[model samples]
Target: MFRNREEAAEQIAARLEHHRGSNPLVLAIPRGGVPMGQVIADRLEGELDIVLVHKIGAPGNPEFAIGSVDETGHVELNPGVERYGISPDYIDSEAERQLENIRKRRQRYRRPPTRAEGRVAILVDDGIATGATLFAAIRSLRAQNPSRLVVGVGVAPPDTVERIRREVDELVCLEAPAEFMAVGQFFQDFRQVEDEEVIAALGGESS
Candidate 1:
């Protein structure tokens, strides 16, 4: 397992060095991804920003994501969503609710949204689990017409890696173990990342 998020970021940074002079925008999924994003921004000399995505949980099993919604109101449903027997009404209401939360988060963050029009967009998360949030985030980024879209993560399931790889221009993931169960399982210190930490990390150029 990796020592911590720092070590993971440093390693990912090495793989991302080619973007250093290209001015890629590193958008992180807070609150766990902020630290990793900060390290990437420092190493690549890129600007740091946030991409807030809220998971649309399955009915009765809130931890299990049926889909996700990004800050821009773009929703991504899992291909297996219908098998879960979730109704369209529930998905609509849940998406609206999560969008409101994203609204509040952006307001609380108080940072002007980054312009993704002509630059490469790199979305970073601590890791991927169901891949719902990252999928939504990638779709949203794609809508902005970025020159390119990339995904960087510390670890993920092999299936998830393959699924996301097709969606982005580049995928820089450190590990995709066959026996993976959760993102935290690959980290030596996988603690809860708080909102305060996210805010502080964004306030600085790097962490």
Candidate 2:
């Protein structure tokens, strides 16, 4: 999308100049976010890291996230949990199942993903869906008491962007396509970001 990832990163990088003086640490949500965060960090001359999380899929449909779980296994459920009259026990059970995936991802991605303690922490993802994952990551990062929390992405729906803005201290979204379907839709090269590639990028193994 937009020629390649560079173009999207540069566009998002422009919004991060204010933090350039202090050099915020970029935390890319693994997979699609690694490349994007690597570019932003390069442009701003900041350190790059990775934030790992897993979606808490709905019971029947694993692809649909009813919530999300972070590296530490903290779960945040959707409003539907209450609105749809789902039980807390059910939510807890689903969260536990997702936590296993989060643990595996963290082990595979980074032996120990660094915490953003008292640092300017930027949360980067290729994009946001219902924002369940982003929200969980933000909540987890808040516990570290980062000096700043920024949500950066290539694109998202306008309403989702607004929701993210409310949760994060700032938002650096490039495009909020009105008819947005999936994050891959806006990308010309929406190829799957392999786990090894994500590690190479965030770990600086890739040149």
Top candidate (lDDT): 1
Q: 1-207 in candidate 2: lDDT tens per residue?
A: 576676788888898988886778899887788888899998888888887777877667789777887867688886666666667788788787778777877767655777788889988888887888888889989989899999889888999888888888888898898998888778788777888887687563532
Residue-level lDDT tens digits of model 1 in 1-207: 998998999999999888998888999998899899999988998989999889998878878888999887888998878887788999999999999999998877767688788998889998998898999898889889999898999999999999999999999999999998888989999989877777777783322
TM-score for all models, in order of appearance: 0.95, 0.91
Candidate with top TM-score is: 1
- List per-prediction Cα lDDT, in the order shown: 0.89, 0.81
Model 2 score (lDDT)? 0.81
Collision count for each candidate, in order: 0, 3
As for candidate 1, its clashing pairs are: none
